[model samples]
Target: MIEVQHLTKRYGPFTAVDDVSFKVEPGEILGFLGPNGAGKTTTMRVLTGYMPPTGGKAIVAGFDVFEQPIEAKRRIGYLPETPPLYPDMTVRDYLTFVAKIKGVPRADRKARLDSVMERTRISDMATRHCGKLSKGYRQRVGLAQAILHNPDVLVLDEPTAGLDPKQIIQTRELIKELAGSHTIILSTHILPEVSQTCQRVVIINKGKVVAVDTPDNLTARIRGSETMYVQVDASGADAQGALSQVPGVRQIAVTETRGSVTGFEIDSEPGRDVRRELASAIVTRGWGLLELRPMRMSLEDVFLQLTTQDAAEPEVAHE
Candidate 1:
């Protein structure tokens, strides 16, 4: 539903977005992740036609964003970092105004407003002044306005930025529910949110596309060795020796505790499953095995590796 090719955005001597390209298919939710000043917002602005790129092209729903901006934008619902709201207006009035600007027909404005208000759970606050609402309610109001036109694509920037934990969870669930029907490109620094709500991710750093793949695939790619954590009733030294003797075991470190118990982390070659061998070794050595489990890399670890790796090398502009 969205395609960006060789997209570059520059301001004078500095480049805000550097030759970044990616695609988002129908029913796909792509998580756009980056650090502060990473050009995530800049790229989103280019896609939304809020800013034009210095070079290359972007297409939304089969329409070129630059060539046919109005038609492209008509199919996109954008909720920017700050909700573009008129604080003086009541929730109902503000949304009604948004509907008109989005070109909702006069005959359909009322029903459109009603549906969006209900979808965003802001119906109860229809008569309340926007400025008088709490942060959560205001965020919901922003969401209502974004979807007021029933756009095919939703570009949400930090949809849960300032919400409380409960509200964040609710917002994530809402976004998940909206998937399949709406092609969404969500930009946020929250890793857990991406893991929970996005099927694929595109990581950006220094205004360049650093990595792109499903969260699990990215993490699995960086997982060089298999690691297992084991607890047993044995001295640290003895546990290490027994585990080291297991076939395929490359490294082992054990921590001794009182009552002959030990905690150990074992590292072996990638794709190796030595759990059974380790258990057999423990039993033969008369050590009581308390725990044995594989250790998987977390999203944070994967993010750090990919971003840091890119930082060390010369930046490669994508097309």
Candidate 2:
């Protein structure tokens, strides 16, 4: 349970976070998304009590971050963008140190360290020095520290930033396993990670909250129309003419053709599927259907639409 109300953070003349508000329900995984200078890290820092906000309040597990820093922090685990680690110390020693500092009972520190190491898949690297570990391993070590105390909430900033593809998948699976037991705030620019790992998403831009909802809802809101990409065996102009006559066809764009196959991007009105009509039209007109597939905008497209464009929300993919 995390609640941020009118949270604002400023540095001199620059405002990093401005009157942002959101709530993370218990056992929910919220994906925090934003562009390079969109105040994601600033918000996380404020919530984690790493720094005091210029204005507003942050409550973690029912404890005010500023007024009750100790209790709030004790119930929240934070992993920053850059893993804070002492290179000279082995992974086990580093996590053990973190557990102690985070107030894990001395008698429970060993079992706790071993458990986190195993959870993060860094058990084999327990004896390896933090400095000598690869970027992926280092990230695992950072995660191990964050979970060593098993806090009620976990705030992770780009937890999979430097991992390989396999490592990324493994990390995502681990995160999925932790979902129900720990409320997590995962901040990452990677769209796929958010789509696959988070239950809900929060997109912020220009120091303001743009949208907060399920990824499917956000994408559906932006890509309001059903789009289909078809390659028909006919002259490009002829193909367009045939498709334009389809009952639900709203718009059509002539794209590049491959060999004798002519490519067309067709859009139908909301809640309509024109594939059957498209196929019949091509066949009745004596044209061969080379390919027919739907085109759904990815989360990256949604991110771009909301962050880069002047629009206040994710833009429609149509021209």
Candidate 3:
């Protein structure tokens, strides 16, 4: 488990993280998402005990990061944006060194090293020098080292960086698999990664917490009124006009047109269901209903709305 209470980090006059607070439950994968320069890395650094916060406190697995740095760090496995690799050492040798420093039992170090390398799909590169490995391989090696000790918490800052599409998917799956055994705080600017991999998301902006909630909940909250996408074959008739007359229909606009089939986006009053009336209206006009479905906001849309605009933090379940 990880808890951050009003954590703030400042460098001289500049505040990199401001009054940020959140909690990651045991075995939960929390996505720390934000745009570039949003202080994501700075916050992760403080949480991992790599740097002290200027104000407030951070607790990792029951130990205050600042008060008990060693204890807190022992439970935390960190993979920074850039993989820290020694070029002169082979992957196996480098990970062996890290295992000793991280306190992996000497008797189990070899087994742990082999297992981690296999899990990260880097077994073939074990003999390759860290510096000579490709960018992707180096990233994988960094990941192997991070989990070599099987720490209770993982603080990954862009773990998938420099990885190709296939590698990214592999890394994503590996992170997902590690969730039940490790409390993970994944920091990245990639919107899809949060939506697909994390159970909850903390969207940060300008060094402040803008929103914290599940991806689905955030999408629903962002759309005040329910929206529906309807594709109709109107036989050259005006489908939008007919749909607009339906009860509870607030607004309707043509989103696309192709021959007789026309697509329309319809907005209805909050808590209202206009699909039935809209369908009836279209049917009465002898138009063919090709498609009808509720339109939910994508995570990207929610991210843009919450970060690009001035957003107030909504009440969220911290624990």
The candidate that achieves the highest TM-score relative to the unseen native structure: 2
Per-residue accuracy of model 2 over 1-319 as CA lDDT, tens digit each: 9999999999999999988888999999999999988999999999999999999999999999999999999999999999999999988888888988899999988888877888899999989999999999999898888888999999999999999999999999988888899999999999988999998898999887888888988888879788999998888887888799999999999887777778888999989888898898889878888899999988888888888777584322211
Per model, state how many residue pairs clash: 0, 0, 0
TM-score of 2: 0.95
State the displacement of the C-alpha of residue 122, model 2, in Å, after optimal TM-score superposition: 1.5
Candidate 2 lDDT score relative to the true structure = 0.89
Ranking by TM-score: 2, 3, 1
C-alpha TM-scores of all predictions:
0.92, 0.95, 0.93
Write candidate 3's Cα lDDT for 1-319 as tens digits: 8999998889999998999999989999999999999899999999988889999999999999988898988999999989989999999999999999999999999999989999999999989889899999999899998898999999999999889999999999999999999999999888899989999999899889888899888888888899999999984347777788899999888888898889999999999988889888988888899999998889999989888886556345434
After superposition, candidate 2 runs with Cα above 4 Å error: 311-319
Tell me the whole-model lDDT of each prediction, alpha carbons only.
0.87, 0.89, 0.90
Clash pairs, model 1 backbone: none
Off by over 4 Å in 1: 254-260, 310-319
